[model samples]
Target: MPIPPVILAGIARMGMTPAALIWGGDTHQELLCGYIAAILMAFSSIASYLPQMKETGKLGFAAVFITAAGNIIISGQQYGIWAYGAYAKEGLFVDITGMLVGIGMMLGTILLAFVTFRAKVFPLWNVLLFVVMLVSFGVPGLESWFALFWGLAYGAMGFTIVSGKYRNKEAAAANSLNLAS
Candidate 1:
C-alpha cells in the first residue's frame, strides 16, 4: 500500500498535542487540528475493534469503541475549556467532570490493550505501545511521547496488515495442516 490508513490517522494523533500548544494564538488552528485528531481517533478505534470482534469478541470491540468515544468527548471538552481559559488569560484546567472523563479514557485504553493483547488480535508491541501511551499521560514532559508511540504502534499494525506477513503465515500453517491431514 502506498500509505496505510492507520499511518495517516496515527499522524493525525501525533499532531494533536503540538496542535494544542500552538493553538493558543488562534482558535481556528486548535479547532481544526483537534477535530481532525478526534475524527481519526474515532476511525482508528473502530478499525481496531473490527478484527477483534471476530477473533476476540464483540464485547472487547464495544469496550474500546465506547472508550474511544469517551476519549473524543474528553478531547472536545478540554479544547473548549483550554481555549476559553486562554481567552480569559486564566491558567485554569479541568473540572471534576473532565478529570473523570480523562480517567475513563485512560482506563478504557488500558483495559482494551490488555484484552486485545490477551486475544492476540494484534501483536504484543501494539499492546506495549498502548500501555506506554497510557503512562505518558501522567508525565507532562512525556505528553508528546504518547502520540508518537501511538502513531508508531498504528503504523506498525498498518504495515503488518498491508504486507500480509501475519495473514500469509496463518495461511501457510493451515495449508500445512491440510496436507498432513
Candidate 2:
C-alpha cells in the first residue's frame, strides 16, 4: 500500500518473474531487464544500508554474487551468453549457479532474522512477520501471491525496523544511556 512495500514487492516480483520465464522457456530481453533491475535493487539496498550497519549489517560478497547470478541468468537468456563460457546443451553450470544463488538468498534471509532477533532490535512479532515475507518470495507455484505477500510484509517490516532504530536513538538521547555502540 505504501512506497516501501511497493518497492519490496517489486523486488520480489522481479526476482520471481525471471525464474518463471526461464522455467517456461520464455527467455527474452524483458528477462534481461528484470535481472538488471534486480541487481540495481540489490545495490541500492546495500548502499542504503551503509549508515545503518547496526540495523542492517553490511552486504557480503555472497549477496553480491547471488544478485550477479540473477543478472547472469537473464543476460544469458537474452543474449545467449553464459558467464562460464559457451553454453552447453546440458547447462549444468548455469543451473548450479542459479540454485546456489537461491540458496544464498535463503540463508542470508535467515541470517537477517537471527541478527535482528539476537539484537532484540525490533519487535519480535515484526521480526517473525518479515521472515514470513522473506519465505513467501521463494515459495514455488505461488509467484503472484508470494510477491504480494512479500511486498506488503517487507514494506511494513522495513518501516518498523527503521522506526525502531529511531526510537532507540531517541531513548538513548533522553536517558543518556549509551546503547550498544
Candidate 3:
C-alpha cells in the first residue's frame, strides 16, 4: 500500500482510467504496473469499510459497496492490454469501458472515504491521505508521477491495518465473533 511504481513504486497507477493512457506511452511495464496497482487500490479502498460500518451502519455499508463496484470496474478493464499489446487497435469498446469504469471507481472511492471519515475509525491523517490520493488528478505534464502520492496514501492505510494501530472496532468485532461461537 505504501507504494510501488512497477512493484513497490505503486505499480504505475497513472490515472486509474483508460483515458489517461490515451495520450500513449502505455508500455508493457506500464500496463502491468497499472493493472497491479489498480487491484491493490480496490482492495485498499474496501478495507476501510469494515471498521466504519459499526459506527455509520448502512451508510458505511453503502459506501463500501460503491467503492468496491468502482474498484472492480477499474480492475476488470482491458485498458492496459488494449493500450500496449497486440490488440491495441482492435476496437473502441475497450477504451470506452475503461473510461466508464474509472468514473464509477472515482465515485466509489470518494463516497467510501466520506463514510469512513464520518465513522471516525481510522486515524485522521491516514483518512486525509486516502482522500487526497483519490482526488489528486495530475497536472498536464506531471501525470506520470502522480501515482507516488496515491501509493503513499494507500500504503499508509495498509500499514495501519496490519499494525492494528487505530483498529478500535476490531476488538469489538473479535468479541462479537467469540460470543457467536
Candidate 4:
C-alpha cells in the first residue's frame, strides 16, 4: 500500500522546526540541526508534489526536483561548514555555490507554489501564507525573521494536510484506476 499523502506532507512541514533552531546559536549542534532540516525540506518538496502532479504535470516535477536538489546541496554545505572551520572561512567557491543554489531554490519554490496554487491540491489559505513568507524573505528588516515565518507556514500546512482539510479527487481516482488495472 502507498503511504498516505498526509503523513508525507505532515512530516515534511513539521521538519522545519529543527531548521528554525539554527537561529538559537551558531553551535555545532545547531548546524547539524540545520543540515537535518535541509534533508527534511527536500523530502517535503517531493511530498508536496505528489498530489499536484496530475494537474501540474512536468512543470511541477521539474520544480520539485530542482527544490530537492537545492536542499541536498544546502545540506552538504552545512555539513562541510560544521566539519571544517577552515573550509567555511576559506572556501569562497563553496560560499558562492551555496548562494547561487539558495537563489535557485527560492525561485524553484516560487514556481512550485504557483503551480500548486493553480492545481488546487492544497488549500488557498496555506498557499497564501507560504507566499507571504516567501515574500517576507525580500523585505529589508523582515529577512531576519524568515525562519520563524517559514516554520509557521509549513506547520500550518502540515496540520491542514494531516487533518484532511485538502483533498485531490483526481489523484484519488487515478490511483483507484491504476490499482484496478
Candidate 5:
C-alpha cells in the first residue's frame, strides 16, 4: 500500500542523523542500509521457523510473515525516501529527549506485557493496542535501538502465540493427536 503523504512527510523529516552526533554519510545510502538490515532480520526470522512450520498453525505463521514483511516494506520505503530530506540539528537536549522517549516506550511495552500476562488473556485487541503503542513511540527524535526493539517485540508477540509453544503440554498434545488421527 502507498503511504499517506502526511506520514511520508514525517518519514522524510527523520533523515539519517538523530538530533545528536554527526555521523556523516550519504543520507540515501544510510536509509537503504537500515532498510536492508531490517528486511534481513525479517527473513531470518522466517528461515528460523522452517523446521517447525507445519506444527505451527498456518494461520498464525502467515500472520507473522505478513507482519514482518509489511513492517520492513513500509518502514524501509518511507525512511529510505525521507533520508533524502533534511537532517535534524544536534544538541544535548535533543539526545536526552530522544533517549527519554525511547525509555518511556520500552517501559510502556513492559507494562502492557505485564498486564496481559497477569490477566492471562492474549486478546487480539491487546495485540492491536501493542501495535498502536509501538507506532506512537516510534517517531523521530527517539533512540533507534529502542524504536526497533519495540517494533520487533510487537511483531514477535504474534509469532509466540501462533507457535503454540506458549501453552502447556495439554494444548500441544491435543493438537498433535488431532494431526495424527
Candidate 6:
C-alpha cells in the first residue's frame, strides 16, 4: 500500500512519470518492495481476521478472503510488470487493471475493518483509526499522507494482535491450532 506512493515520490524526485519510471529498468527494488508489501498485507489480513472470526464468524472469513484475493492479484500484477515491462507498454490494460484492483482492495479492506469494528474484538479506537485512514485515500490533498497513516493504522492493529489484546484467548489458541493443521 505505502510502497507505491514512496516509489512515486522517488519518481517525482527523478522527474519521471509512472510509466516512464516503470520503463527505467531501475525499478527492481521498488517492484520487489511492492510485491513483498502485498504478501505481508495478505498475511496480516489473515492474522487480524483470526480474532474477528470468533465474533463475526463467516462474515469475517469472507472479508479476509476478499482482501487476500486483492493482495494476491496485486502481487501477481507486480510480478508481471517486473517480468515484462514491454507488455505493460502495449496498452492501457495494465494500468486499468491496477487501478481497478486498487479500488477493490480498498473496498475489501474497509469492509473487513467495518466487520471487525462491529465484532468489538479489537479496541474501538484502533479500528476507527484504521477505517479513517483508509477513507483518506479519496481525499485529494491527503492521498500521499494516507499511505503513511494507513500504514500506521494497519501497523497498530498488527501490534494489537501480536500483543494479545483481543478478548478471547481460547478462540485464538484454537484458531492457531487449526491454522497449524
lDDT of 3 by residue, 145-169 (tens): 5565566666666566556677465
lDDT digits (tens) for residues 26-78 of candidate 5: 35544654454445444443432332334444543554455455545545443
After TM-score superposition, what is the CA distance of residue 45 in candidate 1 from its true location, in Å?
0.8
**Listing every candidate in turn, what is its Cα RMSD in Å to the true structure after a full C-alpha superposition?**
6.1, 6.9, 5.4, 4.0, 12.5, 7.1
* Candidate 1 clash pair list: none
lDDT for each residue of candidate 1 in 33-140, tens digit (9 for 90 to 100): 555656566666765655555454666766677777875775676476446755533334545666676677767777777777766756677677777777776778
Instruction: Point to the candidate with the largest TM-score.
Output: 4
Model 3 residue 24 CA deviation (Å) reads: 8.0
Q: After superposing candidate 3, which stretches have Cα over 4 Å from the reference?
A: 1-24, 78-92, 167-181
- Using Cα atoms with residue i matched to residue i, what is each candidate's TM-score against the true structure? 0.69, 0.52, 0.68, 0.76, 0.35, 0.70
Candidate 4, run of 10 with poorest lDDT? 5-14
Candidate 3, which ten residues in sequence have the lowest lDDT sum? 2-11
Sort the candidates on TM-score, descending order: 4, 6, 1, 3, 2, 5
**What would the per-residue lDDT of candidate 4 be over residues 1-181, giving only the tens digit for each residue?**
5544434433443344454455444347656655766776777766566656677788889888898898788888877878885557466788798788978888887888888788887778878877887988899976445655655565565565456567565663563456467
| lDDT, each prediction | 0.62, 0.47, 0.58, 0.67, 0.43, 0.65
* Residue-by-residue lDDT tens digits, candidate 6, 1-181: 2433322322222231232345443266556655665666766677778766667788788888887788788878877877786575456887787788888887777877788778776777667776677777777876445545555566666666667676556665666677778
By lDDT, the candidates rank as: 4, 6, 1, 3, 2, 5
The alpha-carbon lDDT assigned to residue 27 of candidate 6 equals 66
Q: TM-score: which is higher, 2 or 4?
A: 4
Q: What TM-score does candidate 3 reach?
A: 0.68
